[model samples]
Target: MKKYLLLTNEELKRTAKPYLIVVAVLMLLEFILTAAITKMHEGKIETFMRENGVSMQEAIDAYGKSSFAQVVASGPFLLILGAGMMVILISAFVIWYRDWFGKTNYIYRLLLLPGSRSSIYFAKLTTIVLLMFGFVAIQWLMFFVLAPLHDLLLPPELFERVSIAAVLERSGLMYLYDFYLPNFALIYLFALLLIVFIFTLVLIERSYRKGKKVIRIFLQFVILGAVYGATLLVINSDHLFANEKGMLFLAFTFLYLAFLVIIGLRTVSKKITV
Candidate 1:
């Protein structure tokens, strides 16, 4: 257990360092740009109101209906943040692949550890999950930090305060987080299932080499297709099951996760090559 924890911590540090640096740089840029652009738009509105002899409320109402207003409301700064997230998602696969295929062949050392082979799988999985939550925590903290900074830099009336929840809602991430803060369990489960599926595929490829590679790849597709077909059958039978489709889907996903995890562990322990 201690060794597993140590391995996980080491992997987390190795995987997170570069990713965190990129995330931090992008986050800082987004913060500065969001604040600068928002303040600029507010200043333009104020100048227009002063020049036209219109009231502050009237100026605000007019600007609110403009294209610039939409941009400000949606916050283009999030685009950089979103791109960073996509990079992290792709890195998840790279993290696993590089261990096996890198110059060091780290997977050979990892497999030779005096513990269960599943520990390697779990350690990498934990590293990825930790990085994901770390990103989310940083994003949440940024919202709080940027909100107050904006308030201090801009006038109270011009700066409309938006909470992290509101920003996430607008960005469509809240739905993934299940719209409510406490629903993070759903997010965790969904993320775990995805990671498990990916790991299963990785194991399948690792378990075979040149001779039967095409057949092994075909078998993987067949397995995946069967899982998908089963899921669809459950979903389409919603009417027969009294419209409990959501529950049925969740149950099916959990069952598939278990099946994949078992297969992945077996392959990693017995068939995977260094």
Candidate 2:
């Protein structure tokens, strides 16, 4: 337990600087987006009033007031969403490469530690999951701030009342950052399963010779393809198991998750070499 905690702390320390920068930058950009989008919305209302010679209330009634939901649908927000997801997925993969990339051969030292390699594996996985949750928590809080800021920027008559929940619900942001317990739990499990799969694939292929490396890579993709294919097959087969396909699929995913973790632990402990 002590070793695992210590290794987890080291992993967090490795990622702290860039991780904090991404959080801070995301917060600042979100603030700017809220203000800029609201101002543009305000300007649109003014233009409507000017062209039609109507009052603010009339313009709003005619043009429909803007809300945080609209801001999320804007191109800038979608771009940020895409970029943030890319950063997250890249970070997940890069956490492994960081130790392997340089001349230090850090993985050798880690593997040689006087303990089960599972400690190292769990520590890295825990660190990545923690960092991801931290980012999500901070972003969740930012939405509260941004929602009110959005409301305050526009004239009351030109602003459609919107709470954080309403904004997320209406904009479909909930799909990306769903806070509901069951939904979030499922997403978290899928994320864990994915990270484990990626870790296993890298371990199996990382040090292989080029000829064998290609084969290993092909095998990794084949596993991935099989998972996806099985999912599609089960999900679309409505007649299977009297419409209990959801439970069946969950069972299949759980089994696959266990398989990946088992293979990963074994590969790290016995197979991989410096």
Candidate 3:
């Protein structure tokens, strides 16, 4: 366990910089775009309220109130969503490469070491999962810095009307500290399961190198399609036994992952050449 931890830490040390740099730059760009959109919409709000025969003070209040929602709800929220998805997508690639490339590069170096092969795979998988969690953390920190600016242009009465404090609280921004660690762990676990599924497919391919890699990919696609079909058939047809439909699919996937893992272990243990 100690050796596995050390190995994961070593891999993270090598990979963190490029991942951090790319995610940071993309987040900065999101913040800038959101800021620009907020300013433009603020101007439009002021003009529209003035033209509607609103008194100067009322127009000012109206413009600020309307624009505040846009700033918080539309601009920053949408950017946050995009940033989150990008981080996840990039994290997926990070996991894929860590297992695929990282293993291959140091294959002989580590394979000959007197350690468990499954331990090596699990350690690399754990490292990739944690790296992805770090990616989510940095993304949140980036957006946290921009949240205050979202309220900067709002009038005091407008803030009171919309209840900015309660709004922020409900929006999960004020309770960020409370939710941060939990959400990070939740998302990390979800991502870990998903990537493990993908890793299972990859290893299943490696298990049958006597056939073309394309064939393995095709097999995975067929399995995925079959799962989708079975799900749709169960969901669309009322006659399907509800309990059986759900359990059968879950049992199938669980068995599938187990089968792939077993195949992978045997292939690696047998010292098959690709």
Candidate 4:
């Protein structure tokens, strides 16, 4: 148990370091740019108010309908945050592939580790999940850092304080937070299912040596398509049967996650290769 934990922790650290650096740098840049832009807009508004002899509230009401107001409301922070998310999503594939295709071929050593081979799979899965939550934690922390900075730099009337929750709620991405945070168990199960499915596909490709590569790829697509179809059916059934969609979705997700984990373990134990 100790060895398994050590291996998992080591892999988590190795995988997380680069991502942490990138995320930190990107977030810092975003914060600086957002503050600069907010200050620029505030200065313009203040100037226009002074020149026109308009009161603060009057100036706000006049500019509030303009596109500049929208930009200030959303901020440059969301744009940079979206870009960081894209990098993190791409890192998912990189994390899995590097173990197999890196110069050292770490997967070979990983397979020879003590105890069950499925530990390697679990370790990789754990690393990905940890990195994901690490990103979330950083984003949460950014609200604290950026919110006060905005307040200090700009007048309260010029810049409304937006909480992390408020930003998410205002954006179209509110569902992401709602789905993952409040209903974490269901979301985590769904995430595990996705990870196991991707791991299974990686194993499928590795199991094949030279020939039938096209066939294996086609098989993967067909399998994934079927799974998607079945999942859609389960989701649709809730509306059709007039039942509670959340409960039904959770039950279906739990079962699907179990099935994927079983298949992933079997693939790793019996068919995976270096």
Q: Point to the candidate with the largest TM-score.
A: 2
TM-score, cand. 4 vs. native: 0.81
* Cα lDDT computed for each candidate against the true fold: 0.72, 0.80, 0.59, 0.69
In model 4, where is the ten-residue run with the lowest total lDDT? 64-73
User: Runs in model 2 with CA error above 4 Å?
Assistant: 102-104, 176-180, 240-243
Q: Give a tens-digit lDDT track for model 4, residues 196-237.
A: 667766766777666665687677678667876887787776
Residue lDDT tens for model 1, 38-71:
6777788889899999987888777752222233
Rank by TM-score (best first): 2, 1, 4, 3
Ranking by lDDT: 2, 1, 4, 3
Give RMSD (Å) of candidate 3 vs. truth. 5.6
Encode model 2's per-residue lDDT on 1-274: one tens digit a residue. 9889999999899889998898788888988998998998889889988999988889888778888888876889878766766677677778878778855778878988898989888888888788777866887788888888898997677777777777777767776577666567667788778778778777777657778878987887898789879887877875777437756667777888898889878878887777
Q: Extract clashing residue pairs from model 3.
A: none
Give the TM-score of each candidate: 0.81, 0.90, 0.66, 0.81
Best by lDDT: 2
- Give candidate 1 misplaced runs (Cα > 4 Å): 43-56, 65-75, 176-182, 210-226, 236-243
